[model samples]
Target: MTASNPASVVPSIHDRFAVVRERIRSTCVAAGRDLASVILTAVSKTQPDEALEAALATGQRVFGENRVQEAQAHWADRRAAFPDLELRLIGPLQTNKAVEAVQLFDVIETLDREKLAAALAAAMQKTGRRPRILVQVNTGAEPQKAGVLPDDADALIASARDGHGLTVEGLMCIPPADEAPEPHFKLLAEIAARNGLSVLSMGMSGDYEAAISCGATHVRVGSALFGERISPLKPS
Candidate 1:
């Protein structure tokens, strides 16, 4: 009946972060883009505090979280210690949590429907905090996914910008796991370009290099940076 140490089971967060950064650097170079152009947003969801501390020690400031409550638990207190931390809500956000999301997150990357947009608009006005917004596009049109379908993206973007007075800064997408990601990436980039949006948040640990080549301004990498997430319920 011995407890196991997570450190021994997973790769050092420092080493993993360095490897991801180096890959980003090499990918950017090969794509003929400045390394600074692509933001390495370490997807920190489900990672423990120790992992976060290690990531912060490496000067990794941007993080993406999938849940509001989890993000609050992970970073609410750490905000003072890491003032430069930029938190992006990379999951489906419920309308009821708009206020908290607006107050906590630096960027909300899953703006899909008009009701959520209206909620966020009111929340922003109430809290006096305007988080950057990215309309998530469900390029694969998956029913289970949270993003707006590709055909409906422009209307939503326009509504977020014009109807709600929110500054929709960019587009985010998660391509179907089974399909090739480049086409989805290209579609997202095209949507951004036509809308005059500059930021394209696509790619994950597996296909970030291809995403860089497709003009992704931000890549949300998790396992590559923090090692595979270990489930809390799993036996040690």
Candidate 2:
């Protein structure tokens, strides 16, 4: 664990977690918001089991997985080792995989369209398990992303509620990455408010603090909490 060793890591998992937690706390405090309102979803996409073990040692329970197949790959054999972990699928969900997703994820963060909603409804009915779902909104209007357009935020959630047969728990967004995320975060909060939505799931490793400042209910931290994902190209 010498500093110069190639394998030597900075910010022992405990230290990294403390930093992330403190960041959330200070950000929430400075914004005059309740720190407890900000839930943390450790984005565990492509993370190894040992790293997850380290995270668990620090009491990190909720984790976010980007793909359904990856969840099946990572958690299937090792999840029981950590009794506290709750896995959630936080990426775009395919309707065909709805059944498998329900069995593995405690929450689905990407219920975007009517067909997907209907699929989740049918899957939940057949499986007899309903998961908390957050309507994903493309608040930043980035074309390359997967969320619903900003103008349709409320309508999408309504469709999930009326068409999906599941609880419309909240709103989740991935703001444009290259610029300041605060404005987009604030807009998401406003959208949630306008629709009387209770949960706001915005923020990531870079701008989670900003998101918290603007009333983000959940922050997905990966690199800041865990190390940089082995390869950034993959969803985190």
Candidate 3:
């Protein structure tokens, strides 16, 4: 399955899913984790509906997108396309877009600030639906990133849970590209546990296997499973 439009090209969904399944299985086995514990979400950032639909056709219920605009245009129309599929916002939640993000997405995997958390809370009040969210952490503590400071994670998590809206599930982090990931992933899991949180959303296409081994409940993967998503879709 190839498409001239970058979105249409899904080299081999099954083959790709199989490789991922095998990787997930092996990682679970190696980590002494139940293979069913980790759920694989095919990140469909730049891919077309067909690509996502194809994955959904294969019984894939989890799908992720990186931008509010992209998710809105690319997947908002998908309520009927993949009704049972779970849609997640795997990117930073813009403060202004919190309302729409809450309305459209099942999960916002990038909740990183008190303001946005508050905004999502307000949004949920209007929509009568609170979105499940994970606080994004700048685990590497990079100045150029979007997550809240790793040290401040607790304050935000507490706020989210106490808020009238927003289900504070757990933490999400993007480690520095140059780092080993094991330490960072392990750190995220440990932090979540310490806070008594349940979900630890981390890792992407490249090192998710390691992320899973370290107890990542949700792995957001794209390029590896979808074959190097081309631009105008940059890796988030």
Candidate 4:
């Protein structure tokens, strides 16, 4: 199907989804990894409802969102319709939103600090919902980012696992935008390996193939599937 511009045909969500699936399949084959080992997490943040519907129609059940409120708005009602939907919080999570986040998401992929971990542990206990957790590591150590520094990740992971009784499934990272992503992916993989974490949530639309090769178990893809976001929501 084409958009208003006759000169350019816009691929439907199904087409885009198929293309991405093919890419994942081929990348897995090339990496000598099982196709089922890696998951394609469709990033639905900032997308219109119609786009989300289209992706759901295409059988995409795993989605990643950036904000707790936005995610609640997007999936709260639809949960009844799509009971199997797996929601992941891929952005920085605030301690205050822990209860809401614990109730809504199936996986929390941004556990960075001890305070947040404590909040999540409390939230999980209060809500009686234990979503899987992944520690976000600031591999580049960029000051503006929201992840545990490489030097401190082990401590945080241990605390989350032992102290808080939260499940530290794996690690997640967003490499510095200007730098090559493979190094960051490698570092994340190394950390996961040393920490005995099997799930690596370390890729986006731009570098998922490389992430798979570097042992990513979950890849968060957005623009490449939903088209460029037109109106990004301000960070909450």
Cα lDDT of candidate 1 equals 0.92
Which lDDT tens digits does candidate 2 get at residues 1-236? 64323244434767999989998888877989887888999998887666776777788888999999988988887678767668878898888899999888888989778888898889889898888888898877888899889888778877778755688878888988787888888887888788778888889988887788778888999988877766647576
Instruction: Tell me the tens digit of each residue's lDDT in model 3 across 1-236.
Output: 35644344544765688789889998899889998788888888888666776676667788888888888887767688567878888887778998889888898889888888878888988888777888888899999898988789888888888764568888888899998998999889888998898888888888998898788988988877777865774588
Which model is ahead, 1 or 2, in terms of lDDT? 1
> What are the TM-scores, per candidate, against the unseen true structure?
0.95, 0.90, 0.92, 0.94
Which residue pairs clash within candidate 1? none
Question: Model 4 misses residue 53 by how many Å?
Answer: 0.7
Model 1 over residues 11-104: C-alpha lDDT tens digits?
A: 4777888788899999888889999899999999988777787788889899999999999999999999988999999999999999999999
- Residue-level lDDT of model 4, residues 1-236, one tens digit each, is 43323223234677889999999999999999999999999999987777888889888999999999999999999999998999999999989999999999999999999999999999999999999999999999999999999999999999999999999999999999999999999999998999999999988999999999999999999988987877756799
When summed lDDT is taken over every stretch of 10 residues in candidate 3, the lowest stretch is: 1-10
Model 3, stretches more than 4 Å misplaced? 5-11, 163-165, 233-236
Name the better of 1 and 2 by TM-score.
1
Which is the winner by TM-score between candidate 1 and candidate 4?
1
Query: lDDT of each prediction vs. the true structure?
Result: 0.92, 0.82, 0.83, 0.92
